[model samples]
Target: MDHKALSAHQAMLGTEVSRRRLLQLAALSVAGTALTGAPAHAAPPADKHTYRLTVLGTTDTHGNVFNWDYFKDAEYTDSANNDIGLAKISTLVAAMREERGAENCLLLDAGDTIQGTPLSYYYAKIDPITGGHVHPMAAAMNAIGYDAAAMGNHEFNYGLDVLDTFDRQLNFPLLCANAVDWHTDEPVYQPYSLHTVNPEGGRKITVGVLGLVTPGVAIWDKAVVDGKVRFPGIVEQAKVFVPQMRAAGADIVIVSCHSGPNTSSSYGDALPYPENASTLLAEEVPGIDAILVGHAHLEIPQRFVTNKQTGKQVLLSEPLRWGMRLTVMDLDLVKVRGRWQVAAMGAHLLNANTVPEDPAIAAILTGDHATVRRYVNSVIGTSAAAMSAATARYEDTAAMDFVNHVQSAEVARALAGTPEAALPILSISAPFNKDATVPAGAVTVRDVAGMYIFDNTLLGIVLTGEQVRAYLEFSARYFKQVTGAGPFAPADVTNAVTDTAPNGTPDYNYDTMAGYTERLTYDIDIAHPVGARIKNLRYGDDLIDPAQRFVIAINNYRQSGGGNFPGVTTAPVVYNAQREIRQLIIDWVSEQGQIDPSSFSTTDWKLTANDVPVVIQA
Candidate 1:
């Protein structure tokens, strides 16, 4: 390979030269005699020593095998009409392999493979792969022929036993460089994988793929992984392993990072390291040619960041979550001094909606899919009145209250006859899915499950009245400040994009509080600054006492510091039995045989602008 050509290419890209400017420069260099009437030299022929290697990546598949939604009992459809599932992605992978030559292509995933849909939940909680049942994700990925995958934070949701079972069923390795044994300080999973691609007539290319997951897992899944495994910083691990991969004769290095490119952590300072550190990893480390980013659930077709130490640009891409998109990275490698060196690289995303589901993948998981479908569709109870969470983020709704009612009741029952039993009990509920609804009559397990999408467990934490107010203020940051109460659309006021939430606060982060034996009420004064948003916070009929202690029914995710909410992580845990909150809701409905919203529903909270109730139009 010519060093001059590589240098010029990098310089052009560094200067942000446009395609037209590049074409003009090429014409001027190639047609030397056009202006001077001198003898013209022809352009050099294509390099035979150059090879194109295509790597396909997917992240946050989240147990989706088919394009069907078990909760809705129909095909999944979002506002964007984007198709999902590994079956759809399988077709795209097949075409790429065929087009690029199967020997020249590699497939990878950035994790969050299990525990999203009812399909994954059924397998993890009901049949359980630990009991010798094959994980649908493992079966589908094995059929599609994956080279490797990273371990996502959610992979630890079901504990190490389940993760190990899924890992054993995979045809490829599950890599995570930062997840190390607590006592041994040694990597628990494979750090990196090496693949040798032989170009038809050129030198074989040794592609080294390293996987790293967010250290936030240490805090998010502390209950399941504490003392057993610990997650170090992503960049910290990459710096140690990239050198080893180079020493092992790797010509090109690629990272499948389960962290996002953004340098932010939702868990605050709980951990010393940043949760999403892909950008930091590329900038601080050398020898990394590209990275497949994940966990942010955002689509980034292509992004290039310059390495501070090497001054070489590193390519990064993150396909949207749930197999909605697939990232394709193409690397142009040239044989330099008898070794293949990466000369150029770029990536783009392919929408799963562009292709149909691969029959082979669908056929492979049909039985598992059917079983989950039946499980979710089973009738659990009946709802006298229909309830929807469409306005839960901006206003109080019965749908969300139902979640709090069941959670608080369970926590209260557990704390019965205990020292804290006399304390006022409150429960926090977040609008997980805006589309979740409990239709009038015939409430199935799916209806209840759809409301609480996460597999979070129930937990009871003690928080002071002052801390509770602070928590509500932090959650109020989800709304944008406004003056007039003149009918505003929900989208116009909610999910305020700010420094913390560059893409806007997700629905799961905005929580509303509900009382168990008393009425806990507050007003989110969106007309004021964030810290002063929670006004008129009260317990029962009087203003809340600053020093008053209360037991709050919370989820394991929040109590574990998943959302960086104030005071929860340090709060005293009163109860934690590792009980799934979703199942509790199911059981609550089954035991009662009816969901009467009037029994638990109350207009306890509302959004207000300058003490004037805000009217949010749907």
Candidate 2:
């Protein structure tokens, strides 16, 4: 049943007398209509018997077919490389299938199959999947035998046409009840699929799987799917589809949701766009035997949510990201009369790092992997001095300076003829890769790509000095308040450690403002309730006035309100090149031939307190 129907059902159950009498009367009616005057509780034929079934899932693979880091041009081997690729996951899947019995297993994915790493970008933009080249991710997933997959937000990055190509090539169904045609409100892809499986000497079981993508896709992918496709809320769509699946004779219903379990809702009740509502989905929707959660990149191996209506615990699991973990949900069902019901359910996650890479699968994608490696390793330019973003999160580094400088220069060129050209231009960038580095001798496409991981485009916006201060205030939320501190550590300055996954904001949200001469002393106490962390803010030696207007360069993600940055998305957009920032950096270095270290280098922001020395993380 859908969320609303399920809610009414729970309310009916609360009135025990009414509910019990209603069931009793229905049973009497059924018995009265029996052909052979059989009892209401008569057992069904032996063919309709109890059986065990297993559900396995993976999410946010991000197109990693091999356990290799294309950006680093090395084998992905480290604790950080836990469950790095599909090859390793293939091995685990084999072992899991053997243990669970292949006949009883149904394999699935939670979306985000493509987009991430040099390999994915190479195929999407460089090779172009429509150019008669099969995407390695699609090929690898098909080989692994995925029964069904959900729609991830990133799947729309290269546009629907590209997604359609992958969809055409896949052997499994790509389900998304929420991604629908705006006018008709009908799903653009398969909303749900019913998989009929037969265990050894057991009755045929119909397992219904429904897929839902986060409604945040409407905002994140506005450029591509705006007028053609619309994304409705997860709970809203789940409320509609679950009941249909049950009516279609499904014994067990599973939701492969590309969302997290965050308590707060971004869209709220006003719009059908809750970014993370997996918890709400399980609690509100009835007949949901299991949920495979994704998109938050969390490592929740297993969780059981108690359905308020039935008081039955429903299994939920998320396998982190990048093929790191696999969630396996084992269920036992019993046939009562003619209907099958879930008797017992359990779930857990298997780490991909524990197994070796599947050689057969690796061999299939070797040629494509080598092609990407060669492209990334091609030398682009030379750096006069060594640069590193290893400490960029805690301090200003040459690595970030390189990005800001390139962005500012290009944005200035793009805005040369615009009315905002005369205004003071500033660039804002975040340290995407803390471990990225460029040696003094030479730089390759890999070095540039390592510094900027996302496929975000550059955008220029106009903002007043007051709005700028408000922007900085919102970013200051990254820091944790420290009172009466004699000596302060990075933990004292930021809550990076305590922030849990699916709810925690990453370090990338803490933006670093560049191009302007400013000092942020981190005077958090200046405003009693925190958030006022910047002090003595200056733009080229003069204190910034609240009335002054300036043009700022930022990525399209921030311009579209990816981090909820203040005054960014709402601010008047001055320039939109729609060009990828990473590609711009690659082109800039290729043209420059040599990058001088001093061209864009400085330490602009710092943490301070009343006679307290702040120690940042390394």
- Number of the top-ranking candidate, with lDDT as the measure: 1
Q: Weakest 10 consecutive residues, lDDT, candidate 1? A: 32-41
- Measured with C-alpha atoms, the lDDT of residue 471 in candidate 2 is 81
Can you write out model 1's per-residue Cα lDDT over 11-87, one digit (the tens) per residue? 12222434334333322322212101111222212466887777899999999989988889999999988889998
lDDT of all predictions = 0.85, 0.76
Per-residue lDDT for 517-545 in model 2, tens only?
33322233312234556776767667778
Report per-prediction Cα RMSD to one decimal.
Answer: 9.0, 11.8
Candidate 2, overall lDDT?
A: 0.76
Task: For each candidate, give its TM-score against the true structure.
Answer: 0.92, 0.88
The parts of candidate 2 lying over 4 Å away from their true place are 1-48, 265-272, 484-489, 496-503, 516-529, 611-613
Measured by TM-score, the strongest candidate is 1
